[model samples]
Target chain A: MSNKVTYTEIVEALSRKTGFSKSKSEEFIKGVIGLAKQDLDENGKAVITNFGSFTVKEVAERQGQNPQTGEPITIPAHKRVNFSAYKPLRERVNAPFAHLETELLEEESGTDEQESEVTPPPKEAEAKKEPVSPSSRKKDNDNSGLMIAALLLLVIVALASGWFLMTADEETPATDQAAIETPQTPEATETMDDVAMEENSEETNTEQVGQADSPQATEPQSDSLPENPETTEQRATGSVDTPETYQVESGEWYWVIAEKVYGESGFWPLLFQANETLEDDPDQLYPSMGLEVPELEGTVATPTSNDYQRLALASTMVSEAYQRAGKTEKAEEYARFAEKWERQSRQ
Target chain B: MTKADVIKQLAEELDLTQEETDQLYDSFVEGMITLLSNNRGFTLPGLGSFHAEVRTEHKSYNPHYQQMMKIPPKKVVHFKQSSVLRDELNEGEDEQ
Candidate 1:
């Protein structure tokens, strides 16, 4: 190990082996060196056959301190080069003595020269000699056995602790219930009693009243209705005087008018249903087209004036066009317009 | 093999004179050197590729003072044997 050989020596030996002249060998070596430099500078990599590659790497700029002055300095970013030895080079350099060991082993085992000499001793001999030293050997065996027993005892203790923890958790709910019952405030207790007394009084009063009023309540209901019959007829006749009317006006898209009146444009379909003479496609209506806003059955009457009628007619025409094209969403829009006109007329 | 032994063998095999064999050997060496000088690598058909490598500027440690140091990279030459040569040389050994 003390006698370190240089690369030159190896190259000289190679030249001798290959019958290359001294000058030629030097030139060849120089050529290889120059090429490697050029490759790194140009492409950032130099790939040598069977000898691995050299790569150029960039180092980022970083903060560094001057060792001498301990002053902070910015180390400017730079490129660096590195070499990685290939598999063959690594094998040759790392374990040169491997072959020697193989040779020695082969000689000892009486194997062919081609076979590697490095071999460990037979296992049987090593095993048989183990029990010879009784005191130390026995101590070693006892220590191992003690270790195993200690481990087993630890596992048992852990299991027992886990069981205790689980049972303790299960008892917590019962302990909580006992804690809850032990706390009682006088005011809270009084409030609960008051609520119970009030409920009892209300129930008793309701039962007494039900018994006293039942027959009389039934008799008054029939007598009161006839007295309001004339007034009900007058109210019904009053609605006919202010019948709802709708009128169409100029410059309005049916969809726009429908959307403004109804929250959704989809209510237009109901407008077509209200006016049987109008086409199902509501978009065909021109300006000034008239329509009757239909009353929503069983609801308060919505009055539609003449002007409102025309607007409702236009909205229905647009809605019907959308409906005929299988656009149910647009058809529902005009329906809302008629409803809006009816509401306004009633107002 | 020795140079003399190689020459004598070549003479015997090719029926050439010793002087002619020597000339042939010299030309081969010169040719290989020239090829490598121009291309930076030489590929012998059954041997392997021989190439030159360079180590560029890199940051390294100067252990003496426990400080970072810049080691200006240097160029070097290396030889690599081909697979064919490796197999032939290690013919009898078990690969594993």
Candidate 2:
């Protein structure tokens, strides 16, 4: 027996259990989520003991590179929140509702059986009270025969019309071929020749326009090029460029700065690693926090080959443990993890 | 087993018709998808919870070939099973 549970069942069950309207239940759920986020943000941690814990951590500032240009850039400090499941909570979250589904299915089948039994009684009762005449039965049979004949005639007419339309379409293609083979008038030819000449002149005009516009485009290109060169030189001389320095402007959050630098809000941890001098609190960043931008190491940061091997080993271990415990779903999960890590290592 | 097969079994067990089973299954899946897509988690008593987790895009480095490749950010679906289910499955293993 399988218990297949769905969202509707969840919502309906919750509503019924709580004696609340569906909409009210949904609103209550949303409210709980909002409260959870608020609790995490305000208290640094939100713990629902049977469920999980959400914790906000501060990530320090760091130096990263623009992936597109491979040029080194400073990734500023940031804050991020993460969730971790308690053991019992994790188990509950992954549990299948197969038993519940089986129960629901059995209840429905029982009702259906009852309904089927009930349906025959009414039919039997109706049959006991009603009788048909022979003349009326013969008249009904004749009417049905006439209706069948009409339906056949209609089908035949439809087929004939379809055949005619198909033949008409086939005949038109020959005329179309004949039209294509026919020669155009000299006047028409002359017009086409004039159009081609006009197109050639248009192309020449476009080239002239492009040449005239080159100087305007070059002016901005030259200005932008010099700015970069000066900045590059300043960077090479180990001097901080004022324009590139991320000044802690008013109304700035550390997380926001971290997001700008790392191109993701979650990379604040790397930022924290780069700036060890700053306080560890992500929300406590102050103005004029001097951040050191690290030079590019010129190597792509990735999990090592050993990490993949370890992940594979861990997954296999987890699966074996799960199988030994008779946890089919958990075993399957570990199998999926092994496959995923294996593919990642291969890539 | 296929989702439909599971739903069918649920229907049989719950005394529901095939049509009702299908409706329940669809609503459940659609609801979960909607919640997860919105980066929310849903909980069902005696079942498990479904949630979305963010994954960082890591650059792939090959030491042998000396190549670096950029990975992209992704959101993944995560599920956790309930204690009742886990305990039921693991009960026999403790004796062994």
Candidate 3:
């Protein structure tokens, strides 16, 4: 026999759930049905809420014939019944479909990888992101500052060494004669005269910058040991990466090339000095043109690269301090200097 | 089993006073009647549905009697077993 939950089973289950005696539960079940029947007898319908309806329907009887005799007979009218289940009951009857639907829903969600839908986190969740931007910017500034310092220190050392080398070349023929030799006397006089003229020009420029700023004044004496430490520091910092001579690419300007090599076009003046054969105009252009890029020299009595970086840092510091001190004009002046230094660094 | 047997078993199982179970039973009947009298429906979820429908007067020939006759209209109660109940009843059958 098939297992079925009959009216009796329902009563039993209800009794078990409601703590009712078996007889009483049976009485209750019968009472409810009895009332429904009474209502149906009096009225046309009865509703049991979520369960559905007990409907009374009518039927009309018509004429009928006896199949064997073919005799006509009158048929009496009668009543009929119909039922329609409500939502909950209907859903319960098709409960397995619900499980199928849930499975289909899950499958749809799995297959649709909706990466474009960006659900932002709550504001509190992203609080960490707010402070990060400023901190990252500050760190960037710190890195650029360090790079500037390293580059400046490199340029400074390069300058001091180049100056000392130039001075040594000036004095080499007279004192360091063992380090110099000529197979014949034909070019000796010419070379010595050439060296003398170079020294004279360099000395005149050094003196012209003013007695207070001369190379000799910067040190206790010009011919001293101050240049050695600078040269050692220069070698230690791996300045060999700086190319001494760059082949002039056709159609490229000197300023553009200087900017590429030294990160500043101001150093093109030094290029002119190194490539003495180049025209004074600095803009005369030709293909396959050769130019020399010399490092800075202390004897030039000009501001070194690091001197400029130090000046930049000082300008910004002064600007900020003055701004805090309520000196707007002074602050703006220093800020302009800082901006100029920044521009120079970008050159 | 009979409806009496069901109530008896239910009372025994629930341990409720006879009056309480009887009251519950009375209320259900009263509610169903009140709802149906107003042409509403009653559904015992997972059990089935019950309803009422009107039939109009008509004339028709009865196949058996082989005669034409006038028919009067009437109303009657109806019951339909829920799919779950039907499935339970016909558990071994292949189709619903």
Candidate 4:
């Protein structure tokens, strides 16, 4: 027998078991459901011995927000129908797993001591790796911090130098390459330089962020890093999968691409940063142009405040870029987008 | 409706004796229980479908007792209402 036994089949089975006509059995089944419905409607509850009970529950009205606009709204109250099976019927349904037993754990008095003892070995291992007096340890910390800052500074210098060289060429190809590299490098360094006086201070702030992120990040990276390339290959070839890049179609603009990718027209700046070939002229997108869609850790389906902050920063950069290019109207448009995202982030 | 109330109503509607109606109701409940216990689902055309689903076991911390309790996995019956029945029940709900 297949899993789903239909109504007629059940009636047929009922007739065979009860020595009643099929029509009579069907009528009985219909009558029971009708009565239960009436009972629930009138009394808000119905009880059937050895079967289950049905209840009509009133759900109170609650405050909510319109997801698109972030405007506060009221969710109207509603009625919900609920069913709970009787104990005998519940036990019958659970027959397959009846042998399983719940286990209550006894709390151990030494749990705190055990955790403290467990934590020391890892610290001891780290200490063994860098055995030093207090002064030497401080020196080592400074040296490591300097090393990171120096590396980041070198990367920024190299990218800036490359952009300058590309500008000197006065050709589209070099500019295209530079444009792709320019958006990320300049934006990152701009924020760092604006906020901090020294590279060493920037390094310390970055280290704090890294430390905060590492506990969750390290466990996934240990195994997933090896599989990343294969997954990217799959994504590139699989047309049915979630698209990682969008090919610009005829009549499409930055707002359309932004809408398609991030579900908001205001997020065009994020799209610009992903491609950056559109940096010089954001409106000159041609057909068959492939634009990368940067994979965000969390999608806008349920955006966090942190996501809004990042989007606001991107929008602000686009506004600043347009202002520098002497396009006041376009700059103002992006500035409005930045303001909207900033307000959302604050909320 | 209580089982006795249902039996009485069925007896009146179908022109059957109380004893016969009671027997028929028991037989129906027995059949449903047997089908569900065997991990098979049944659909009543205008009413609904009854299916058994297995819920996985998991450990939950009991903050009051300061200990973890492991809940064992088990199968449970779920009833989904037919659209026709749902609409009938929710009729004029939106107008309210």
Candidate 5:
């Protein structure tokens, strides 16, 4: 058999083998080729079992240079037909090379090949990943620890501020009790001095009141006089040893005086309640006019709605007192306090 | 076109029965396989040449296993189309 046989010779051999007419065999071959061409033109593929497949491939347009003229040109895109023979046919065709078998390199040779190729080993990559995971975990732990410490510090600050405010409220009543006990003994002067020092540091007017009361009580002790009428009078009314009075200072209002004496401007109406014989309008007070600072009978540190109610009642009383004095303008000015207090209590 | 279509067309052209046309087609296919398997190559004058080639054994990487794999030597059929056929296939499109 020849290495290459022409199509006509194949048709001649087919006609002889099948005992068919040569013309009919040639027609069959032509039909097969035509069918392949039509299939490739239409669907871009044609398959013949045990023979081969024809496929149409697209070649893209590209830049080209003409060899003779040396001028740049654009090559147009086009379709091309490709062919691949079947596996069984290929196996039979390649029988002469069947003895060749593939070989795999061992581990040592594989590592040597990898080194020559300049690719890192998988074990080394794994080693690098192992350390990175722990370091990232440690960083996460550090971040979480820092967040927890910051949260703890915030909670402690909140608790400490709450405790300080509570103690400050509790200390106000103790200072009031010390004031009431001031004239009982001359020895109380030392305690009063200590309380006054704290009041001065706190920027309150209680220090001046303490100093004024202490001097009066200690003067009698220094004189060593027996049975003074003022001292006997002080003993008779222990609660009101010397009515603690505050002289209205220049540019001072009732609320300002209240804040100075009681440490809270909300107790402003307490000033009006203590001064029963005050004929002048409570809103209008002349400097140097004496206003009494009465003992705080109830809880005034955290004033409740009841305190606002007391203020409303005190406003009504002042309005009535102004009306009795025939000061209609003063009465009208004070009348708004009842309405304001009522609104405050409702809230 | 399918084998049935080719058989019918061949039967009409040859003035033969469908069974004879079908038998004739089978004989042609068997003759081609026998001739091609024995010879190195054959040329279809108007179309192309069919040749068998032997691929050498080679190493290939299996990415899924992260290891090297072996591919044994194998045979493949190669088709080199004739200039006449190639020119004919591209003739209509070249004008565009």
Candidate 6:
């Protein structure tokens, strides 16, 4: 219950313990406390072995009220003493808990140390890093890989479809009539370009062989010119207020369809929302299915004449891939669709 | 422990005169006071290091005086136990 632990009393105890005169014992105690004070004054802290650590922190100025006068005042910043017991001493203070499992005691001590560190809030800020989403990291590989594979496969299929369509055209003379009535779709436009190129080659070969043959084979070609204006009229009419129907060709995914129609791949949702076949899986577009290519409201943009040709070429190749894969139903349907459009654009 | 008891024990243990020990104790205390007043800290090996520190100026209210006060920046003295001493203190508790 005795509270006072004065410097004089400490000196007396020191003197008695060392069997020294009162003055000598007092002087020893004085020297130690004195050095400690000087250290505190200059360095703001002092350390004593087997005891604890002392630190001095600067307390910032703040507002405070006088208890008696009820008057507000500014409390200026000042030095504050802090004590942290060494690991050994601290463990001793917590000796009662030390009997518990050593790991548990250590864990509790570590948390205490961490909590003490948290007194300065800035340390917490350094602990947190900018969170890059795990999902974003995971998707990087899949996206790039899928894009490259799809493009390579599409190119190979397109070339094959072009060759197939040319051979088919040589056999079917009735295709000339259907070409006049059908509206030029993207697939049709591409088929026509291929057909025209193949015909030029064929014409040269025919000339080489027809040294003895007659020129009557050129008559059907002359008949095909007047039918051109009729198809142009239909393009103009097709560009009017109504939405035109498109026959889905092989290898036509909603993403590509949206890009061809809307000028952006992101518009795939529009195609997915508009079509029934795409309802179950927007990526599962089969060849030869009729799709209502709805006109965008308030905007009257249509795929360019060139776009139709490009799409036709691309889809024709996609169908060829289906043929090679043994899905002949898909290949034939898309071939029929492309042939229909090619004739339509022959005008 | 009391000063008399300490002196008695040291006298017995060292076979030295109490008067001689008291002289040695006095000189050590004087040396410490001189160094500390000048804002220096003393270190004892196997004990710990001692040093002084400074704080910036600040203001505060003195409740006892019932008035606001501007407290100038000042140094404070502190002590830390040496690791050796701390280990000694922690002894039996650390035994597995």
Candidate 2: docking tier: incorrect
Writing each residue's lDDT as its tens digit, candidate 6 over A173-278 gives 3212222322212233233223233335333333222111112233322332233223333442455443344434457776665555555654344444334220
Regions more than 4 Å wrong, model 5: A62-75, A97-101, A107-347, B57-71
Local accuracy of candidate 1 as per-residue lDDT tens digits, A82-102: 556565444333221111110
Mind giving the per-residue lDDT tens digits that candidate 3 earns over B1-96?
333443454466556555665556544444343233223344554446655433333555544333343343323334665565444333453431
**What TM-score does model 3 score on chain A?**
0.25
DockQ-better candidate, 4 vs 5: 4
Worst window of 10 by summed lDDT in candidate 5 chain A = A182-191
Candidate 4 backbone collisions, by pair: none
Q: Candidate 2 chain A: minimum summed lDDT over ten consecutive residues — where?
A: A96-105
In the range A1-347, model 5's lDDT, one tens digit per residue, is 23565677777767755678888888877766666666766787876655778887778898989989999988888766688877766655544333333333334235454333323233444454455435544654678756644543443344345434543444433212232332232222233332234234332332334233233333443332232323432432354322355545557787887776666675666677665432335566544334556655445564467767777877776776678768998788667877887788677
How well is each residue in A1-347 modelled by candidate 2, as lDDT tens digits?
01233555556644533455666445434433444544554576654433456665655677888999999987655445455765543322222110111001122223353334344344443343233223333554578766644543443344344434543444432212112322221222222222223345333433233122223323333333223323332343344211123334345654465455433333333333333221223344443332333322221245555545455655665565456557778678767877776777677
C-alpha displacement of B84 in model 2, angstroms? 3.1
**iRMSD values, candidates in order:** 31.3, 22.6, 29.3, 12.9, 32.8, 28.6
Model 1 chain A weakest 10-residue run by lDDT: A96-105
The whole-model lDDT of each prediction reads: 0.41, 0.42, 0.44, 0.63, 0.57, 0.42
User: Residue A77 in candidate 4 has what lDDT?
Assistant: 73
What is residue B93's positional error in candidate 3, in angstroms?
38
DockQ (model 3, Cα): 0.02
TM-score of 4: 0.43
Candidate 6 per-residue C-alpha lDDT over B1-96 given as tens digits, one digit per residue, 9 for 90 to 100: 233444454455455577764455444433333222223455544345444333333445555433333343333333454565444333454321
Which structure among the candidates has the greatest TM-score? Answer: 4
